[model samples]
Target: MRLQGKTAIVTGAASGIGRATAVKFAREGAAVLTADLDDGATQDVVKEIETDGGTAYGIATDITVRANVDAMVAAAIGRFGKIDALVNNAGSRIIKSFLDHTEDDWRRMLDVNLTGHFLCCQAVLPHMLDAGVGRIINMASIAGNVGRPNRVGYVAAKGGLLAMTRALAADMAGKNITVNALAPGMIASPMNRGFKENDAFGENWNCENLARRWGEPEDVANVAAFLASDDAAFITGETVTVDGGSIAALVRQGE
Candidate 1:
């Protein structure tokens, strides 16, 4: 019950990492406002939280639009009375060659993955500022830090997200507002379905990390929960890599 009295807003709460984080926060006693583009899916998440004896509500939101973002925040405050934390987990990816990417593709990718987060932060910060304390968690990716193939736009967006996290934290310094990021590597989520379907690719990636297995959404959710809690009150402007130690290890092929 680390977040017993907290109220949190989790974007992209329909599935994957977003769903896991929403459930985890609710279990820890946060009154969560689950926002997602899918109205039905968000309601499902809300139901799950309610079944577990937690307080929560679902709202259909398109974070890329400023109006929708503002409405989502208003809804949260209206239901929960205040906002204590925010998890910017909504994103999109394009697994196409850089040359194959179109201008629309590039712009849309950034709109969902980077700019949407920016809008969400902008909409929520004023309320947080009024309260004088808040936590902002940005869901970044390991690809942002390391090079990867066929995802130039995704890499750029995530990389920019990490940089934004740092800048926001700097600006929030001494304001009792903490901003941080989580860089996850090869998690088993709908976003990685294509790679996981390829047995060889899945097996090879499993060995790329120290854990020798894929990361679960809950793996990252646990860390997000901590960051949202008072336990991490002193921590800010940091990127916590939740990759099963993949970045720290150098496992040679066939080792």
Candidate 2:
């Protein structure tokens, strides 16, 4: 009951980390708004929450579009009467070398991964400010912290997200709005399913991580729940790395 009576909106809630976070919020007594580009997929998540006796609603939202993002936020406010938390969980990745990436590919990746968070954050901030309390958790990646081959746009966008998170946190300090980024490393979400499918990719990913095993969606969800709760009130302008000690070892070795 950490989020009792709170209102939360989770983008990309149809699957993976987003879906897991939405369900986790609902279980903690929050009125969850689950949004995804796929309406049917979103509804399935809503149905699951309802079956578990939790309150949730589904909305088909294309986060890349400002109108869609605004409408999604509006719907959540309409349903719950206030916005308490916004999780910018929608993201995309295109595996291509910098030279191989086209203008369209770069734009698409930036739009969905970074710009989407911008639009959602802008849309939710007013309500959150009016309420004088809110949490904005932006999803980032370890790739943002370190260079990765074949993911130029993704790494760039996520790096920008981390910077934005810190900037917003500083700006919103006195407003009681905590803005932070969660940078997960090699989570076993649908977004990473392709790597799991390829033996070489999986092996490389495992070898890079100190845990030697992939992280689950729930692993990120657990951290999301903590960041969204009152316990994280004093924490802002920080990027919490939930990478199973991978980053620590990497930095240590590099030094």
Candidate 3:
């Protein structure tokens, strides 16, 4: 297995892409520490992984809080003995227009999507540095790369994450640590179930992508496994888009 004997901490792992990544990491031979605010849900995920013969643990964590972030790091260290990778996947989005977005909305988006990732990175960096080898996968979005009309705060937060990925990669240069971001497309995760329910929204995304279908969380999770593995040792500061050609083709595949 690619991740044999490694340890990974995955945030927002209660569901969707986060849960998928945690399971994938564990299956690939990593001891996974899954963190999310939904304790029962995350515990369920760990149980499922354990049932499948994977090493996994779950913790209730609010990434927006520093104390919680500290506890998360400590839990991983205490349970797994060392940290090999950190996947900053915990995030939230508000579907409101730029004009309709309030200050509080903006703060909430930035707090969950950007600041939370920042805090987690800070808390885990020292341990990674101590180990002398690490991978940090920050979850970004295609909306950040291409502006989405109704999600101002989400776009801004993810854009900031993209920049932060590059900056941290530079900071970690020569330290045997790599920082990268994964820009997922319109994934068919529970987080986007609302959009999926809306015919117009779902149709538009499907039509926009060359794949002509919504992306599955596993699609992104597969890349997560690769990025967290040594196979990506030479990669850093890169944003790998898992949108199934949505960003590349200005013209839709069939259109």
lDDT of 1 by residue, 116-147 (tens): 99999999999999999999999999988998
CA lDDT of each candidate? 0.94, 0.92, 0.94
lDDT of 2 by residue, 171-196 (tens): 99799999999999888888888888
- For model 2, what is the error of residue 201's alpha carbon versus the real structure, in angstroms, after optimal superposition? 3.7
What is the TM-score of candidate 3? Answer: 0.97
Question: Global CA lDDT of candidate 3, please?
Answer: 0.94
Give a tens-digit lDDT track for model 3, residues 156-224: 999999999999999999999999999998898999888788877655656577787789999999999
Task: Point to the candidate with the largest TM-score.
Answer: 1
| Candidate 3 positional error at 4, Å | 0.6
Candidate 3 total steric clashes: 0
User: Candidate 2: lDDT over CA atoms?
Assistant: 0.92
Task: List the candidate numbers ranked by lDDT, top first.
Answer: 1, 3, 2
